[model samples]
Target: MRRRAVVFVALALALLTAAVGIWLAVAAAARDTDAAPPVSVSPSASAAPVTADDYCYVEAMIYYRVKEQELAETLLRKQGIEAGASGFATGIAARDEDELEDLRAWYLSWADARPAEPPTDGPCGGHGSDHAQMPGMPSWSALQGFAAAEHPDAEKRFAEILHAQNAGMIALVTLILEGDPHPAVAESAEAVLQQAEADQETLQGIIDAVP
Candidate 1:
């Protein structure tokens, strides 16, 4: 009877040890899993890749047009602009409005919404800043200066700003054309480039005529 009791006690001890070892192993495994980093899986590409530069160009051009329209409208409001410059401002206002519509249409076709801010560095990721500064566009101070000036100064400033804006537009269009732009975008850019070139000549003439 004593031997049987000893044997039973030994069997119970062995079972308890086995259970504790298993529990410890399981706890260690759980800790390891908790410490492990999650594996990341990349999605397969299903469509043609679009570059940030291309996207920036489209949105930036739209911004350019809107600014141009504003400047033209301001020119019209001035009291002393020459007849020719005033006529040109009117044409610019009309043309930019039409182009704005076209760009908005193209933008809406793919983009869910327009960019809240204009890109300055030819990329889309740095849109966190609220200031819409871009090359070829007049600074706020310059615009203000133009507004305050009289006659020849205002006209000269207007001509210079517009010329710079046109140059910026042409550069962006040319950049887009050199890449794989959408057919509609390509067509519009070519038209814009031709128009900008013509406007450059006209602006140069205006600048020269300013006294």
Candidate 2:
């Protein structure tokens, strides 16, 4: 009887040791998993700066104020006449007199917004001239007359104006947002000149079509 009791005690001790060893192994694996570093992902890259085309449009509109207003008036008239003619040509074309009237009003608004020519004393502390003579400068009267003509078929002309306007607006917004600190601002200003050149070409096309 004493031998049997000792044998039973020895078996129980061995089982306990085995169970403890298994539990310890599982705990060590759990600890290692918890210590492992988490996976990381990088952020997306920033967008490129606005294009030269965009800058030119804004500069022409904003800096060459008088010329731009003249251009706007001419373009608006051409668009209006074309829109009216389209309504007459296609029975489906609804004459939104109100919309046309609103556009006319906006055209006038564009004209009104222009800054008068700076005196020789200069506006904005003579900073105007430094930017004024920059490349792609348009003659004020020439662009004005170009803007004034009627276009019975002004779809192409209108498209050109719209493109120029959008580019200019984008450049203006960029300048305002980024705050032109470097010489890049001047380069951006030259973009306005480029837009004026484009506008001139479009205007000439319209002039050629005029009766």
TM-score of each: 0.67, 0.27
How many Å off is the CA of 115 in candidate 2? 17
Measured with C-alpha atoms, the lDDT of residue 203 in candidate 1 is 88
Model 1 score (lDDT): 0.63
**Local accuracy by lDDT, each model:** 0.63, 0.37
Candidate that would win on lDDT: 1
Model 1 spans with C-alpha error above 4 angstroms: 1-54, 112-131
Assess the local accuracy of residue 32 in candidate 2 as a C-alpha lDDT between 0 and 100.
Answer: 53
Best by TM-score: 1
lDDT (tens digit, per residue) of candidate 1 on 1-211:
9965654564454335433533332243245544322222123221334445545655666667766766666677778789888889899877876565544443433453344455544433443342154558676567656656567776788889899988877877887788776555566778988999999998888889987
At residue 155, give the lDDT of candidate 1: 77
> How big is the positional error of residue 46 in model 1, measured in Å on the Cα after superposition?
17
Error of 2 at 186 (Å): 1.9
